[model samples]
Target: MVQGHYESLNRKNDERMNAIPYCDTGEVFEADTIANVWKREDKEWLKRTQSDRSGYEYPRLGESPYINMTDDFRMEKKVICQDIFWSCDGTSFVSVHNDFGIRQYLVPEESNTDKLNRNLLLPFTRFFRNQSIVSCAIDPFYTLYNENSDRLAGDRIVVGGKNFPLQLYSLMDGQCILSYDTMNKINGEYETVYSVKIDVESRVYTGSCRNKVAIYDKSRRDAVWMNQSTKKASKGRQSIISCFEEQPMGGQALSRGSLLCGSYANEMFQVDCRHQRLERLNYTRTVAGGIVQILTSDNGRYVYVVRRNSDAISIYDRRNLQHELNVLRLPFRIHHNSAKLKAYIDTAYGLSMGTPQGTILNWGRDLVEFGGVPSHNSVDDPLITSIPPESEWRTNLSSTIPATVVKNCPGDPELFALSHGGTISLCRFGG
Candidate 1:
C-alpha cells in the first residue's frame, strides 16, 4: 500500500508505526437488476461515457427519468437546475423548479433516441440562474421520502450549512413548509451552518463549523437550546471542517458533530454534540489534521473518513470515539499508473473506485488495483465505476454510468441513480 509508517504521537512526531489489521463484514451486497443512469453535470450536459471505450454515448433528456443504478439506491436525477425537486413513480417523475416551475417526463431508454416524453408533467419549471434558496446544505442535497407515492416529501430535512436558513420542504410540490433562519436570531454569533440532521420525532439538529451547536424541536420549530460557540474560549478562528448524522435514527434525541478545519498538523476532535462540546482527540500518528468527508454506514456501524494530505481512510467506532479501527492507505505505484488506465477493487463486501489519474491499491492492506482516471484536470477517458457490484445482498444501490450513454435492463424502481455528468451513474451502497 502507498500509505504506511504513520507518525506516532505517543513520542515525537517522526516516530513511525506499523499498520494494524482489521476485519471485514464478510457479507456481499447484491443486485437484483440494473437500469440506465442520467444526470445534468454542474448544471450542464457532459460528454458521453461508457464501460467500453467505443461504447455508445449518452445524451441529455428533459423529462424526469429514473436513472436507476440499482433497485435499492435512491433515484439519481439533476434539475438541469439548482433549487429544484426531482421525484419519480415507478415509470415517470415530476420535476419542480425553485421559481415555482414543474415538468414531467418519460425519458427514452436508448442512446439513439432523442425524443423526450415532454409535457409528461404539467407547469414547466420556471428555473432562474442563481436563485438564493439554500444558505448552507451542499449542492445535490440528499432528499428522502416516506414512500413511493407520497405526494409530500421530506417529513424532515437537513438544510442550510446546518441552520443558517433551516428550511423544511413539503415534497408534494417542493413547497417551503418552514424556514427557520436561526442565524438571524442568534445573539450576534458567527455562524457557518456546517451540517444539519433530522430525527424521527421531528426535531432538527444543526452543527456549525465554528464549533457551535443548536437543537430545535419540530413541535416548536424554534431554536430552543442554542449552545454558545465553542471558540468563545479561544481567540482564534475555527472552521466546522465537516459534519454528519449520528447513528440510531428516529429517536426524540439528536446527536451529531464535526471536524474543525485547520492545518492537518494536529489530530481531529470528536464533538460531544451538546455542552460537553468539542473534545480534543488527536491521532498519535500525528499529522495535525482535521476531518475531510464524513461517510457513515447505512446502519451507522462504522464512520469512515479520509485524513488530509494523506490518501489513507480512517475507520472509527462512532459510538463514543473509543478507538481507531484501521488506517487504509492506497499505494503510490498504483496511483502512478499510465493515463487512460482504470483500476477497480471489487470484493465480496466492498468496491474501491479510482479515476484515471488515481489508483486503487490495498485489498487487505496494500496496493491491489492500480491507477484511477488520470488527473481530474486532464480528461482522457471518462471512467464509469460501480460499487458493491450487484450481488444478492447489495444489487439495488450501485451503478455509475455516464449520462450520455443510454442502455437498458428489464427492470423497474431502478435502484441505481446515475452520477449526473461524466459518468451517468445512479449507484451507491445501500440496505
Candidate 2:
C-alpha cells in the first residue's frame, strides 16, 4: 500500500447500489451475465453464479485509444477512479468506489479490446446511497475468498482520525445491514481508521493512526494495538513508525502468509497471520524511507515490500523472517507515486520456495504472466522501469553495495522510470 492504488483521473459524482460480476476467464461459467459462479474441472463451484449483474462499466484493454499507455500494450482505464482495488476472472470484474458504490464491468474474452468502455458495459448490481455515499472518501479494502469472488465488504476501510466517526454497516433485506455508530477506540473514543488492510481470506485487518498499530482479527473479533515513542524508544515492537511522514505508510502479509509493514519512521514489522502471532521478522531500519506495500504468497512463502520515501525495497524469504535477507536500492529517485509489482512462482517446486535469485522484471497493466512468473508489457515510462517493478524508488542500487548513501543527485542506472505520481505500488507474490 505505497499509497496511490490504481490508474485514471476522472472522479465521478454518480453512485450506484449493486453487485455486478465480471470474469477475466470464462472457465468459471457459461454465464450470459453472471458473477462469482463457475464449475471447475473438479466439479467444484468456481464460485457462485449471479446472472443478473449491475454497476458502472469501463472499457476493456485496448478498446479505446486512452488505454494505450504504450504502443506495444494498452489497457482501458476500466473505472474512472483508482484509489481502491479491482479483481477479475477474465470475463468481467467488480470495481468499487469507497463510498459511491460498486460496479461490474464485463469483458467478452474474445471481443476486440478496441470496442470496450463504460457504455459497452452493463450494471449487474448496485449498492444504494444510504448504505453508501455519493462521495464520502471511503477507502474500502477488498479481498476474495476461496468461495466468493472479490468484493467490497466495507468491513474495513480507512476513515480519518478519531475526530471523524466511522459507521460500520452491512446490507440485509435491502436495509442498513448492521450500521454501528463507529468509534476509534484506539486513540481514545476518538480513534480514526487511518489505514486498513485485510488478508487474503478477509480474516484480519491492520489499521493505523498517527503513531499506533492495531491489528483486528475478524474471525475472533480480537485485536492487538501498539504505538511508538519518539523522544525515546519504549521498546517491544510498539509503533509502526519512529517518525512522522516516515510513520507506517503500509503493511501487508508476506508470500508465506505472514505480516509485513513499513513506517515512515525507521521500521518494518512482520507477524504470523495463521497463528495470530507477531513473527517480528528481523528488519533493519535505513534512511531509505517507509514501507508502502506488503505482499505475501498465496501459501505464505515469499514476501515483497517497497519503501517509497527512501526509494528502496525489501525482499524476504520466510526462512529469514527474523530480518531482511536482501535490500534493493534503485537509480532514479523512485517515482513512489505510481508503482506496481508481480512475482512468478514455480509452484511445482512447492509453495515453500526460497530466495528471489533470478533475473526477474515485471511491468504493464495486465499483471500478466511470463515464464512461470507473472509479467505484463511495460507502461510507457522508463523511470518506473528503473525503479524496479515492486517498490524500488531510486535507481542504481545493488545487493553487493555496502549500504545506500544519500547523495544530492540521482544515480545512473541502465533504466529510466515513469513520471506518474502514484503513492502506492502493486506487487504480485505467491498465489
Candidate 3:
C-alpha cells in the first residue's frame, strides 16, 4: 500500500511540473509584441494579396515581425527613492525617499517614446517633518475603490521611519490623516520602528523594531498591545523582555488575527492577536541565513523568508512548519542592509528580488511544489553550503547604484523596480 501511494504521488508531481511554464530569459517577444505583430502581419497580408481568398505569405527567415515592440521602459527621479509600493488597483504606485518625501505617479499605460524622457507629473507629494521614510504600505480596502474614481479616494498610506511616528497619509491629496507613536522601551531604552503594515479591515497597524513588535489600534489613537522577546524563559521566574539580539525587520498579516514576522536572528514567528494575551505559534529558525523580509503566498499556503546577503530563500509549508520545503537560491547576492523580495504567483514571472548592484533577478518555479512539505528530506546541508539552481532572469539596471525594492503590479503586465540613485524601471516579460 505504501509503495502504491508513492507511485501515485510521483505521477501527480510529474503532472504539476509539466503545468508550470518555464521562466523567460527576456530574449523573445512578449505578449503585447506578439499581438501587435499579428495585427501588422494581417494588414500586410491584405495589402499584398488584395483578396480575401488568397493564402497569407509569411515573413522572411531573417526578419522577425516583433522586432519593433518595446518590452521595457525606465524613469528617473532626482532624489533617492528608498522604497516603493503598488496600489491595490495597480493603476498607480507610490515611492518614498530618504528626504522624507512621498511621491505618487500614474503608471504609463501608453508611451510612444522608448525611454520615458519627460519627468512624469506627480499627483501629489507629502513631506514629513524631518523624518526619513524607510518603509511604506497602502490600505488594501481603499485601493480597490480608487480604481475607477476620477479623484482617488478612500486610500491611505502607512509610512514608518527612524525616530518618527507611524503616520497614515491620504492617497487623494497626500495629507496626513493620522499618526501613532510606535516607540517603546526595550531594556530601559527606546527603539525605533523599522517596518510597518496596516490591516485595513481591523484598522490596526503593526510596527516592528529591534526587539519588539507594536500593535497600534487606529481607533484608540494609541498602541493597544506590544510583544517583546525574552532572552530566556523559566517556569518559576519572571522572564525578562528585551531586544538584545532579535531584530524583526519585516512582517505580514495572516488569517484569524495572526501575524508572521521574520527577524535578523534567523527566526520566524507567528503571533496570534485574537486575544489580549499575544499567543506565539510556529516559532522556528530558518536555514536561509539572517532573514530580513518575509512574504506569504496569495493563498497563504506557504511562507517565503528572504535572507540578508544570501541568495537562497527559505520556503516553509504553513501546515507543517517543522522543516522548510526547499531553499531557492538565486544567481546573485542580495543587498545586505536593505532589500525586498516580490513574488508573482499568478503571473508568468514567478519571483523577483533586488540586489545591491542595481540588478533585478526574476525566477520561475513550479508553484505546485509549494503546495505541501515533502515527507522526506532532500538534503541535510548547512545554510551556507546549499546552493540551488540559477534563476531564469538576472537583468541589471545600473551597476553604479543599488536597487532598493522591486514589486510586480497586481493587475497589470509590468514589473516595477526602484534604485538607490533615484531611478524606477518598469519591465515587461516576453511570453
Highest TM-score scorer:
3
Error in Å for residue 357 of model 2: 28
lDDT of 3 by residue, 1-431 (tens): 33354346545533332111112112111113333422443344344345535565522212222234335221111345566766666667776654445556566554444332432323233333344555666665445345556433447777766666677777556567877766454454334555566664445545454346667665455777777565433222222111111111122323334666655555555555565443333344433345556655545667666665666676777776657776656656654444443332333344555555655544343342343223242336223223333233334334566556666666763444344354555554431
Q: Pick the candidate with the highest lDDT.
A: 3
lDDT of 1: 0.32
- Model 2: per-residue Cα lDDT over 66-86, one tens digit each: 222333221211112223233
Evaluate model 2: give its lDDT.
0.31
TM-scores for every candidate against the unseen true structure: 0.45, 0.44, 0.63
Error of 1 at 55 (Å): 36
lDDT of 3 at 420: 39
- The residue ranges of model 2 lying beyond 4 angstroms of the native Cα positions read 1-80, 83-92, 96-102, 113-189, 200-202, 215-258, 272-280, 297-299, 321-332, 335-431
lDDT of each: 0.32, 0.31, 0.48
lDDT of 1 by residue, 1-431 (tens): 11121222212211221111111101110111212212222122232233327655433233333333245343322222221122322232333222212332233232322222111111212121122233223112123334535332332233453224666653234445676646544475436555564543445656654455566765356676665333332223235534433331111122233422211222345534444454555433434244434444333445555444444555555564446655444332122122211211222222232322211212211111112111221444333221111112112112242121111111232222221122222222221
Question: Lowest-lDDT window of 10 residues in candidate 3?
Answer: 240-249
